[model samples]
Target: MKRLCTLVAAVLVSTSLTLRAQAEETINYITAGGIYLENIQKAYLDPVGKQLGIKWSVETNDVDTPVRVQVQSGAVTTDLVEFGASTCALGGAEGLYEKLDYSVIDNSELAPGTFSDYYVGSTIYSMVIAWNPKKVPNPPQNWADFWNVEKFPGTRSLYRNAFYVLEAALLADGVPKDKLYPLDLDRAFASLAKIKPHIKAWWASGAESQQLVREGGIDMIGMFNARAQSVISDGGSLAYTFNEGLIDFGCWSIVKGTPKKDLVMKVLAEFVKKEHQADMTLLSNYGAANTKIEETGKIPADLAPLLPTSAENYPKQIVTSAEWWAKHGAEAKERFDQFLAE
Candidate 1:
């Protein structure tokens, strides 16, 4: 009987030690600060950590400089990171990220083409035309209407970033949507010149765009959907159109040499779960990359139109091609800067 008791005690000790080992495991995740991080923590990291008996150390940094530094130095601390589509493409090519294990990190819930071998889509944000309905009784319906200062006469705001600005300019100049790529710099610049004097502010951040509209600083602007939604929710008399919207997305990636690659992949799988994705939208106003979440009917009807990935909105907008931008962004940006100066 004593031998029996000792065997049982040993079994219990082994189980306890294994559980403790599991509980002590940790993964470092880096993402943009503010509501994006907050929502991820509440909807994913905290809950998933509890379920998996692991800990997640959260950090915030928008740029991929830290990840790049870690990769070059051969001492990687970050396990997972959030990157914009273009940055992910550049980093993936440089071998800065690990090829994702889709078997463990399911991509089935995400929109088609949102997941690649090295990255998985995290959120969908878009550049939409936002206007104060009171200021412009007839809001600009499309990019062309935005450029027509004579018809919708008012102060305007645009992103300081050159990529979307050039795209918008080309579209406003009557370039067919199907032929937007291989952007015509000369024509885009010519189109921009017509609206240059009317642009009251060149916004560099989402907050700046939101402030301009909320305070009535700009009558119409090309702004982020998340920012515009904030303004609208604050009782600001603003309306945004998804027509001719420029779709942009950010993705999640794992550091190439992280020791916890398998565990990190499991965490990523949780990030794209329908429930977590839907909850993220409630907190950040950014669209869920998981298309399945739309069918869940958790997102409010009024808020659906604002999501860049919504069935109705997604079809009407142009998905920004990260590949094309990677190839020609520098030259386009240089020309755009020169146009701004002149």
Candidate 2:
């Protein structure tokens, strides 16, 4: 009888694992549209679907509003939804997100707190001058070109942050890439003044930037490279150049109370593989969350040049200096505020 019971227990565990894979064969996911959705389809959804013998339903939007609304309705249509960290925390606090099972999703290689009980960050991105080549057939190649509105006529947008804005202005005024560490506040502001009237919006968030591009709100805008590519892939009239792009990171998360948690969690687990993360970089220029990606040589030699952290792209772009900003950020921000008011 003891031997019979042990055999039964083993059978049950095996059955449970099978159920997780087979239960809810179609997992619904929602995220920002464009190349992001396309890449996920190639790197995660399509491949994982094949492996698990399942299908996926994906929805796209510019923000988390639909995901939030769906969860609030207590009948989440989406099994997995992605967001930046702060909004993910909000969803968790409001009970819209549940504590993720670390046992199911590997967190070993991930940055600490990359995923809390609610969210996970899987990629790094860069800010770039995204423009519609059709609108301005010959768009800006560098910051100086961007400021030459007469030469490349177009409505423009920029980030609300003084960091990128200041650096760009100094560059527009002919400051060398290496010499941009201690930003020239006086010269930077003056450069901005020349283009201030043509500035259609000072986008405050990633979502707003997407909205601008998706809706054709500007002829050219400073935006995330991934998002610009995403919208362009989704049929928005935009393309990006790397001249002085800013680099940063963001997070992703799952919705709470989705009935198919087991299957969705499995999908999340598949995303943890360094190989899959590397595949994501190949699909989108956004850098991978996997630290092992570089060491593993997952990104190809030719492809590496196109990515943000690559040897070729790094020298030409602008990365914010934390040490420089730590001291001068306050005064710079104050001046930017005053300039905006003026």
Candidate 3:
């Protein structure tokens, strides 16, 4: 009876080993919803997985709601997630994300201005002045200039998102970059109200804003540069100005309570390597989060100007405060909705 029991225990242990090996064969990553993940998977995840002796399977979806459900129910499918800064903040507050292992990941490899402990910003994107050059001979260069419809004179569109428009309003009201935080809510709202009558449409999506400018629904817009670049590249008569833009961040994080925690950390450590980071940035047309890529002559000139790494432009930009936004996002949204309704 003892001999028979020992043999059965050995078989059970062998079976467990086989299952563990199978599970480690592939790592899963969750990405932001869109074609963006295809490039990220091909450029970053797949190759890194191979280097780390794992296969990668990535899915794209909006963060927060799906992630919240998964964690609360003890059904965490996502191993890694790429989401907006605001989403990362919200997820952290809910205790849904794992604090990253900075020792293995090496924060020094990332571009100087983009690193953090809980999450690493994946890209720097901005809301800028997009104009149809043919329609307007002189494009707006600064906020004061942009707000001068009497001179630039045309129908304009801006983001429907509260965070962006509020910053733009402050800029238009001559608030310097250094003093933007602790934003004068009452004054900012009032400033936005002044431009309310001039807005042709408040764009609600990247696609919507792109189409709005391309189709001439509005001659000028406070636009997300990535979509604007897409429209312009596709032969649309649109051009963008980066001056006084609202620079925002998107980040990647590991979800807490995942069964595949070790695998996820390995994948992240590989994901931020210089070569993979450069490849992802080139395909995405966003700033590569890696500093070494910028230093080693890897970045292309045409792409360089658009990226946040170039020496000239990096200093001009303002880093959005994710922690502050995360804390106040719901309250800001509530107040913003009320302001819009009125």
Cα RMSDs, all models: 4.8, 8.7, 3.6
Higher-lDDT candidate of 1 and 3: 1
* lDDT for each candidate structure: 0.86, 0.76, 0.77
Query: Model 2: per-residue lDDT, tens digit, 1-342?
Result: 999999999999999999986764877777767657778788877788888777878787545778778877876777787754445665666677767888998888875545677776667677788887778799898888889999989889998878678888888899988898778889999999998999988998677898987774688888888777668668877888887886545556677778778777777888877887888888786876666676667677876755776667756676655445546766888999999999
lDDT of 3: 0.77
Model 1 per-residue lDDT tens digits across residues 224-288 = 88888888787888998899999888899999999999888888888888888888887778887
Note the residue pairs that clash in candidate 3.
none
lDDT of 1: 0.86
Could you tell me every candidate's TM-score relative to the true structure? Answer: 0.89, 0.60, 0.89
Candidate 1, position 235, lDDT: 86
Clashes of 2: 2
Candidate closer to the true structure by TM-score (higher is better), 2 or 3: 3
Q: Candidate 1: lDDT of 25?
A: 90
In model 1, which range of ten residues has the least summed lDDT?
32-41
- With candidate 3 superimposed using the best TM-score fit, by how many Å does residue 324's alpha carbon deviate from the native? 1.7
